[model samples]
Target: MHIPGFDTTTIGVADGIELTTAMGGTGSPVVLLHGFPQTHLMWRHVAPILAERHTVICPDLRGYGASSKPPATGPDTYAKRTMAADITALADVLGLGRFALVGHDRGAHVAFRAGLDFPDRIDRLGILDIVPTLDTWNVLHGVDAAVAFHLYLMAQPPGLPERMIAASADEFFGHFLDIWSASPAAIPPDVRAEYLRACRDAVPSIVADYRATATVDIDHDRADLAAGRRLTMPVTVLQQDWGSALGFDAAAVWRPWAPDLHHSLTRAGHFMAEEAPADTAAAILDLLDR
Candidate 1:
């Protein structure tokens, strides 16, 4: 399920966790990080377009896909901060002194952290369909939080989430693939199957990744917020109109963290890169131009 015309390789980042990455193009680098239950393959349609003008690196976050999945030995192992460091190390290994970064869903959380932790290395930041981790927890309330039931499910202490998800992996993963996409045809049969298979096999690591959001990741975000740390790079956020329904001003939520922010709502589903590639590519190009 590699992106066509892209070369795939496994590069050791940090914590001895090697990431399986698909890379293409030949100019300034732009790294794309995939979300949960999916891999670098999500960028298949969007990457080629960005590749025309910039080198695009798409990687499966450490816990998912072909990437090395070390057991969550500690609270920080799967934290977004740890995942963010992997991107910095990867850029160092690839000789990219600085690079633009974009991510969707869970990956967007990592990108947000990277922009804060490595402002010098992350030239630009693009986020798709997510708010910051702290804000996410803050915004969800009462029945509305049910929209993200999985977050609460995975946030629980280890054994239960791993067991529950693994027991019905396909059904669990496939549920998001089905419900989140407004245009079902965007994810053809093959790609969807690949996502499910990847998720099914990586349940423990995936759960750990999510669990961190509820623990160490929040602490990190709180520290940054308290320190008045903000993303110094140009930031672009594209989202489905979930904020309107969920009762939060999406742009307002992002503005404090990203002073230089361009936020827009998309017609596409949560998987904007796959559902609306051309538009997604355009947004990345626009972000780069900023």
Candidate 2:
């Protein structure tokens, strides 16, 4: 129940959005973004550790956890570009002109979009357990499709996915809490309840977030590819060994987009932040130094 690094503070990031954030220590800024089915609490172990020397700002991404759930105006608002805009706006509100960015799962998708959108603002980027939108769609075929079922499921038409997810929110969101985590024992009852509640509340925005993936994300990636735009900043990627089992080298796939890429395959599952914070933190520091 007690998250290791607890520092609750609210910040008005955007219109009608007051994000619940956890700030620790004080120094250069390092914004930590949480994945799905979790919150700023997911960074409990990693944030404070980084906060030992840096000002760590971990926020519950828009429509997730304690953050305000604004109505999804359309695909534009829920686009990862818009979500990334929220983060940068939060940084500006907090007086962070530029900073390092680290994100896991859904957050990582946003971070990748942010890096492409605001290359100057992000000094270093660490994307945990994910590939780019174009890569994700291009790679999925047979068994690979099974690993990323949520991408397909959430990409459905308007009210269908939302209705289904809302029907059994806890069971829907808690699936990852139990499976993606190597040490499911680490996430106790209360934390799991909180995660479920957050997911339940943000279902619309969360669905919009993924739904944008099928549209705006594709357009964004195509534009970037055509423009020959790649992340100039150093990038560290840590993910499971899905490539070997699926018959593709994940790193080989990443090298084209990121010239300075450090890819590592971990024993942990998708939720590496909780399962292997030490390694995640190490990879983050390594990226920052570059």
The Cα error of candidate 1 at residue 5, in Å, is 0.6
Q: Which ten residues in a row have the lowest lDDT in candidate 2?
A: 1-10
Residue-by-residue lDDT tens digits, candidate 2, 1-290: 33455577788867787888888778888898999888888887787678777888888888788888887788787788888998898888889998999999889988998999999899888998888988888878886689779889899988899999899888889987887888886777877888888888889989888889998989998999999999989899889888777777899988988998989989977878787888788888777777
lDDT of 1 by residue, 141-181 (tens): 99999999999999999898999899999999999999999
Q: Name the top TM-score candidate.
A: 1
Stretches of candidate 1 exceeding 4 Å from the true structure: none
As a whole number from 0 to 100, the lDDT of residue 267 in candidate 1 is 96
**lDDT of every model, 2 decimals:** 0.93, 0.85
Let me know the TM-score candidate 1 reaches against the reference structure: 0.99
RMSD of 2: 1.5
Error of 1 at 109 (Å): 0.4
Cα TM-score per model? 0.99, 0.95
Candidate 2 is scored at a TM of 0.95
